[model samples]
Target chain A: GESVGLHLPTLSVQEGDNSIINCAYSNSASDYFIWYKQESGKGPQFIIDIRSNMDKRQGQRVTVLLNKTVKHLSLQIAATQPGDSAVYFCAERFNNAGNMLTFGGGTRLMVKP
Target chain B: GAGVSQSPSNKVTEKGKDVELRCDPISGHTALYWYRQRLGQGLEFLIYFQGNSAPDKSGLPSDRFSAERTGESVSTLTIQRTQQEDSAVYLCASSNRVGGNQPQHFGDGTRLSIL
Candidate 1:
């Protein structure tokens, strides 16, 4: 079965520093990818997303990079904050279907103040 | 309007008990989704509802899980005779219209703990 996965289970970074979270997906047919952040006991909050056609996209202080060849994706967060210390997940989607996004195993991001 | 809302922020039940999770998507949003997140695991897609079209339950893990949406408003997910492994946080999300840029607003989620 196809699955979306993360390269690392956890990442620790100093506050105000940059943080990068990586994800690898098995399905190449997915057209869209999204990054979400989840705090303790809270639902996932959308961060940023990029389509398959584009290699990179940025929003606010976050950027999403997609590599179709390697079926890999990454999220870059600028100026990590204590509030940003949470689990980050990457999701894949297609427009034709019901638009449900497949999620990757989350990577826990810890920001030390 | 609220972004998205879910009921019963937490639930604890016996292994043989059933559970129901509710979600109220943002006003006028036409898409709804249900997902489960276990500890140290990724989100598992359970069901998807988009407007008037037939829902997609392809991601449902077993027959114990079922969901339904009324018109374009609220949605409910039911789990029958849940086992201990069924315990997890159930998250709900809604998107404007199934677009690339529109973000899928998520609710706080319902944490289910099976004893």
Candidate 2:
């Protein structure tokens, strides 16, 4: 029964403020975690990913933090902008499961200009 | 230069009708995946294909759903006698390999609606 879940359904923030989205996963053996952003009428786009070996990974404007003990993962976005408003999803891939990804209920990030 | 591509951006069909959705993975990619996204939901894994190996169809919901891939390139997902519950966006993704860490690039997806 592997599952990934988010702490919030919606996150609202000011245009220039920082944003943090939280996720909780039940599978301890999952070795890979990724965050994706989906805009209206578009597919999920890969934003950042973190491996079990590392606690954190940073992308251009995003960072993913992984905490194995509590089975928690978080995505932090700096300088949130209107273009950054979208639904964000966290996914996990168990090392033994090939390339199958289990996605979590998405968190919608709303940036108010 | 191109990413994954799915055909018929939109499809509306009556209940019980059959539909075929196509996917064109990136060139030279050996892994392909099919996922379903319902309204206001996350992506649901459906099936996966890697190279010449038998596909992993464990995620397929029912016998009515089946898929076929020619080599490692194009793939087609067919739904026979579709039901209203089957209405969802069918997404196709591909990665260079089947490794756990490899990222999968997705297509825009084909929106399926059952009337």
Candidate 3:
């Protein structure tokens, strides 16, 4: 079945360093993608999103890069902080459908102070 | 000024008992969604509602699960004869009518524990 997946289940980084998390999706028809940060005991919080029309989008200190050719997406966080430590998930949405998201297994980000 | 709100942040029940979860979406948002997340997994789409259109329930795992949304406001998810496998965090989100292109605002989910 078509699905979205992440390359790593866990990523450890030192404070002040850059963090990059990768995802691979198999749905070619998906036109929208989003990155969400979920802290413990909380819901998934929207971080950034990108549409098929654009290859990259940036927000605050986060950037989302999309590669349709490779069916890949990446989220980059600059100067990682303890607050940034959480489970990050990448989700894809097929335009043909009425705004439904297919989510990928999360990547847990751990920042060492 | 408020975000989505959910009732009873945590629920614990024995097998065979039924449970109902509630969600209050952002005011004026017309799209609402329900998702389930098990331990160490991703969000599993359960159902979605957009305005007065028929809800898409294809993601529902079984007939035991059901949900209802009144107009564009509060929504409820009911699970009947709950089993241990039903233990998970139930999440609810809502977005502006613009669809997936717009980020969905999520509420802190309800944690369900079935023993």
Q: Which candidate wins on TM-score? A: 2
| TM-score (chain A only) for the predictions, listed in order | 0.89, 0.91, 0.92
* Candidate 2 C-alpha lDDT tens digits along A4-112: 2234388999999999999998799999999999877777888998899999988887889999999999999999999998889999998799989999989999899
lDDT of 3 by residue, A3-78 (tens): 1123437899999999999999879899999999988888889999999989999999999999999999999999
* Alpha carbon lDDT of each predicted model: 0.86, 0.91, 0.91
Q: Please identify which of the two predictions, 1 or 2, would achieve the higher TM-score against the true structure.
A: 2
Best candidate, lDDT-wise? 2
**Candidate 2 at B8: error in angstroms?**
0.8
Pairs of colliding residues, candidate 3:
none
True contacts kept of each: 0.60, 0.60, 0.66
lDDT of 1 by residue, A33-86 (tens): 889988777788888878888999988889888999999999999999999988
Q: Among these predicted structures, which one has the highest DockQ?
A: 3
* Candidate 2 clash pair list: none
> What would the per-residue lDDT of candidate 3 be over residues B19-96, giving only the tens digit for each residue?
999999999999999999887789999999999999999999999999999999999999999999999889999999
Rank order (by lDDT, best first): 2, 3, 1
**Which residue ranges in model 3 land beyond 4 Å of their true spot?**
A1-8, B98-100
